[model samples]
Target chain A: MSDGVEVSVVLPAYNEADTIEETVRVTLETLDSFLPAGAYEVIVAEDGCADRTPEIAARLAREDDRVRHVHSDERLGRGGALEYAFERARGETLVYFDTDLATDMRHLEELVESIRTDGYDVATGSRWLPENRADRPAKRGIPSFGYNTLVRTVLRSDLRDHQCGFKAFDRTALESLLPAVGDEHWFWDTEVLVKAQRRGYRVKEFPVDWTPKGDSKVDIVRDVFGMGSQILRTFWELSVSPRITRRVSLGAGTALVVVALLLMTQYLDPQAVLTRMAGADPGIVLASALVYAVSWPLRGARYRDILSSMGYREHWGFLTGAVFISQTGNLVFPARAGDAVRAYVVKARRSIPYPTGFASLAVERVFDLLTITLLAGVVMVALAATGSADQLLVALTDGAVGATRPPAGGPLSPSPPASASPPSLQ
Target chain B: MTAIVASARTDRNFVRRTVGALSDDSYADYVAGVVERFVGDVQTVAADASAFGRVGGASLLIWSLDVVTAIVVFAAFGVDVTLAVVAVGFFAVSVGNLAKVLPLTPGGVGLYEGAFTLIMAALTPVGVATALSIAIVDHAVKNVVTIAGGVASMAWLNVSLTKAVEESQSAGDVEVEADD
Candidate 1:
């Protein structure tokens, strides 16, 4: 595709003295099988090697014109070295790999062919694909699986392996994508691929046999954390910081309130309810309020007992206050959001784990339901035995029928004059 | 050494039995496995024997107060109700209380009122307006007390309602993590 060279294979090496010569020899042989002598060249980026790697690479460069070495006096990371080599590449297509040749050499041809024949702007090798074969211990494999899953979730990308280290790129495509890829370290591969996808470029993935070779230079924990942060940064830049998120949240909240109001108006009669409330007896209201107030302390005592049984011995007053706060939250919010508040109170004030608090809350609910159901069951059986069940059903159905009747005053006539009510049933 | 070999043999037999059962099409084995796990978790949080009376007594007291509140409100409305009628109304109130736990609305607002009023009209010869009036009064008294109590508790504990709600939402997230 270019005047003299069809492909440039860049091997980014750093302190790879042990495997540099063999890697170079195998690469040269691999390229020679498919290309003419001058059609392809191998560039070994000796990235500030403090060992015999630079000397070996330099010697190889001198022995054959096809083998060239680019040296940096200071440490350029894997991405930095690739960036340096890519700038000097003369081929129409560029390929890069780790110095250890972790990927099978057979797939190298397939990667390059994908760009030349399949018309993909970039071809990446995947070790995690279902058809791919990778030989690595669980110690390494587990983290790799986890990291890739995080990448897929956070960046919302479909690439199977972003850190495979064996990728081929169309020269023009790489140059166009390079301006947006700012990472100089391990995250460069992910940034470039994500950006490429966002820009609607076609990327092809090929299954490859990958075997771990030599000791790895990667600090797994550090790199995982660094990549996680980078993923978040990219997500913020590409998605969240925009005005669309705020607009959608605002719109959804408004819709919920409007729908809730509409439902409330449909189901409830505001005028009748207000009228009844106005006529309510103050003395009876005060009595009901006192009974309700008494129940709060009882509820608190129950909560304290449950927590104490669970080995979280909190003061009775504190537990009662916690229940009050949680109940308040329930009253204020919908869907029992206050239950979570209760759990938080337990965790914050008593140092109990949230789950344990939640479990206790669940137990309390079970008891409450059990008690209320038992009472209701006993009363229903009593009513049935006394033959009052039939009368009650008749009255209930009559009242329901009366409610739907057309006339303003039917069997369920508007409240009969309070002073002229029928004689007491007693 | 003999005990160790015996225990290992027992464990192997158990695994073999489990595999054989699961290989069959019958779902009884799966049901048993689920039941066993559930029972094991329940066992971990079982309350101490000593606290049983306190919890039981508190539950009874709370339910009794709910019934009393219903009775008092009905009387206050000048409704001619007998003792038996009062008992029947309490049953209806209990059912309504249980329905409130469903969270159909804030504090089961419309749901509780509908259920309670329907039961009142059915059990007594009261007009729909009277039943509706009774239902509203009953709920208002409870809710007014609840709001007042909540505000007072917030002040007593020095916790803001907003912070409580936020903490509650986050606690739900923590529960999900714990479950995982």
Candidate 2:
């Protein structure tokens, strides 16, 4: 059992009374061939546990000296626990894995070997990425889709799997990135990779066999959401730091501000415009307001639908906020700058890409238009039969679609006969 | 799932019926086509169309409210019945088409209402026309204000419209673009 320390196995466990022992047994059994029998110590940083997870872990520690266990009464969560384990690991290349064995032992060995002998700075399990970790349930896969998206956009981290827990890091890369990752919970995966990536570290992913940890404590909503924000925070921090070489531009924001200022001028005389507005009919005002307030949720829903269809899952609150913000931007910024803003926010918060985000938006608009067109044709014709066609026609013709129609009689309407308008070569 | 089911109830009756009236079967067929085409183009087919990280839920609401808003305002302003039909119908179709041109109005705030009023006013009675106009202008003002707020928030959030629109577009390659 004589061997030099090549791979250090760091297991960050919180409360794994049900499956941890199995995870260690499998790893030890499988890893004995690859590395020396006593070369590796399974450094288990047992985070504050309320159950027998710590006690059981301690018992195992006594059975094999290689099974080292450290108890930190203060719960540093997933990220902090791993940080501790990595710091105390005995191997030259530190590898931290999920205690539930989501990543199978064979893949774990592969991961360690990929970095130990090879020159890779970090190796992670990618479920949907090029080197996919493993097959995942729709629930797990769906959230990863969203998490990866947010990571790509907000942090500009190119890695496809943002939340994969089974990963190995070179001691140099780990030491460099570990300090920057503050999230004590889930997002720590991205924090480290993004930081590592930004620092010119070579990170690679491999598809590995993994099982969805059945008794896993991952609160998808709370933990995922919290990680999303932290991902953005890390991205921002990385992007702004002179120490990091990778960053992206916040595009056209200044020009957007300039145009927004111009649009604000229109509402300045809301009272004054009343006469002009009411002259045309106050009905339009009320209708317009209804459209504005109500569209928020609808637009949000549209986004939700597209993402769901795309297999990306997120909370409705985040989506609605995205729609509200984006639509609101389009309204004020005359040049359609709101779309950019909306995409940026969502990308920042959700870790999805801008291109993918806006694609859904285009679809929502088309559907919306088709719906509007249908109403106009049928309802207007009905009004025409009732002799109210003129008013409805006026509304439709005046560019109710959010553009200025040919002014009252300037060219298109009532000023001259249709034949005389000369088709205007529009 | 419930929210999705609830929102997916896009009130096809209105869309279907509206499309159904063009020229008997012609109208119905046309409506059906419009529905198909519209549904086809929407982000429903795309995988990543959302505001931030959530999905889009505003289509039905936006469409329904457009109709309801028009009907209510026209009624409230004491618009003549005859004029209401044309203005309401006219704005309805035009609003959707307008979205096509811009490819990115966010939520069609000021432009939608303003254009709706201008287009509808020319074809209706003074009373009805005036009411519809006011409805549109008010919506525009609010929309403009909302856009302003969104811009402010974008600044706070440090995002851009291009990023939002492009990301959404990336969710599905509908090939739809901003014409205006």
Candidate 3:
């Protein structure tokens, strides 16, 4: 073993005949600046080449025992090659870099510092320091640029760039992350970051410096489309996977409370509401039933559309049944317990991440809330316009006597407890 | 030979069905084809009858934006407006949702209005009084509104009221097809 190595720098190489030897020489010579005082090993994953790439890498390995070479008969792309090399490597802190050397050894030092000392679970490099993406070529860069923007807008992730590949992680972090890596292709980077975020592990994105390497084997256009689809899917998931749906479920349960109140309104002469239900017109009862019955399916359809957009062609009927069963559990129990049931059903049925499937439920609710608010807004406007504004104003001030408040009390608590009944109403 | 026969049959019919499903003009026909399959099925019939069970389950499980709607509508009355009339009016609709949910009681029978009425019953009297007057008139308006809203939604969707009703009816049933 070359100079008794301690760090393993696993580099996955495709048909980079022009840059192969230099990449190997540079990595071996610059090893002093990259690794600690102990021994460092370089692993080149040789796949995807008709050239003498494997031959050159082997000669380097033969000359310097510190350099280890792996020749894969079949090309596994960047992800598979790394998977193979990392599987074989003995490095305590496993790191993989692009052969282009676009990002220098100095950034590796920073990554090493973050991993070794900075109390972070994963230290990744980001190129998202600037919006230089627009300067990039269209077919390759446009989709990726548009994709990251979509994820940030929809998922609202602070990660500037999830698509960049020049990342280094603690050996332990990589080991832990690798098992859950769903995609064996370019989407590997996006998946790893998402899993880290969802699992509540600390993932730090540090901007790195780089020059784009030669005619990149990276079909950037194709991968960006795929990664975008993946990120959106995960965005739908983790956003709703947590207790939000259940909270929403709990919130939906309150619709019953609302219904009860509406029915009560008919009876506020309580005597009359009952007589109306019993007598000539059970009209209110029928209307209320229609609302309750319609809520679930409308919700199911929303999720169906969302899933289809994300590349899962789910049957609405199957989704509706799953939603129905899960919600029933949520309603029977309190505080959104129905979410676990929902997660289980989807995971069991479709084998999707519980959180991603759960997010669809939450997204659906966002729609529902928007719909209800818009309708409520119209109704409120109508009521206010009719000079019933004073009535609407008082109800907002009056807290539920015993009705439990929203756990987050989000929009409901926007106005601090002033109790100032719209002074104009006065 | 058997595999070859199976392959041939799939190639013969599958291609036609795929084209039929994908053609933009055929989507309506494709969806109609599915609906027709369930028309005579017992489980589908049973499902329509027990649609409440599915809808009931959904409210507790779904946790959608509607929750915010109920809260916002209810909150509007007291939170800022502080008018007894508005508070009661918003509440009537929320409870109207709740009472409707009651019948689907594991997903059973009750109304949002009924459930809401109960919540209001527990509230202070003045608000309850306002809530009552609003409930009486709101439904007449709400029905017009619900119908208008439904019609508008159907129109926006480029579907018929018949389809909307079918969707509404089918929406209540949990399993139109078996889960894979």
- In order of the candidates, what TM-score does chain B achieve? 0.73, 0.37, 0.35
Runs of candidate 1 exceeding 4 Å displacement? A1-275, A388-426, B1-47, B177-180
A11-120 in candidate 2: lDDT tens per residue?
Answer: 77777788879888887777787776666778778888777889988998999877888888866667777877777777778888877776667777778877887889
Candidate 3 residue-wise lDDT, A1-426, digit = tens: 544555678887877777988888887777676555556788988865678888888898899777888888865655777888888887666677888787755677777666656767676777666733324456556555676777676766667777676666677877887887755556677777767776777888887775665554443323444455556656656575664653475566567656766654452455543343233223433443344445556666645665554456777766666655555443454543344455555655677554455445543443334334444466556766766556434544653322323323422232322133331211
Query: B56-119, model 2: which lDDT tens digit per residue?
Result: 2344456555555555444434433344443454464356346435533334443454455445
Instruction: Give the Å error, residue A169, model 2.
Output: 1.2
Which 10 consecutive residues of model 3 chain B have the lowest summed lDDT?
A: B38-47
Q: Best by DockQ, which number?
A: 1
DockQ of 3: 0.06
Q: How do all the candidates rank in terms of TM-score, highest first?
A: 1, 2, 3
Candidate 2 segments exceeding 4 Å error: A1-4, A129-133, A215-224, A239-426, B1-180
**Candidate 1 all-Cα RMSD:** 15.3
Tens-place lDDT per residue, model 3, B1-180, is 222223232333433354345442222233334333322121221233334234323434443333333333333233333444344435445445534433233222234434444344333242333333224433333343334444443344333433322333343234323210
Q: In every candidate, how many clashes are there?
A: 1, 117, 95
Model 1's CAPRI class is incorrect
Question: Clashing residue pairs in candidate 1, if any?
Answer: A396-B122
Stronger candidate by lDDT (2 vs 3)? 2
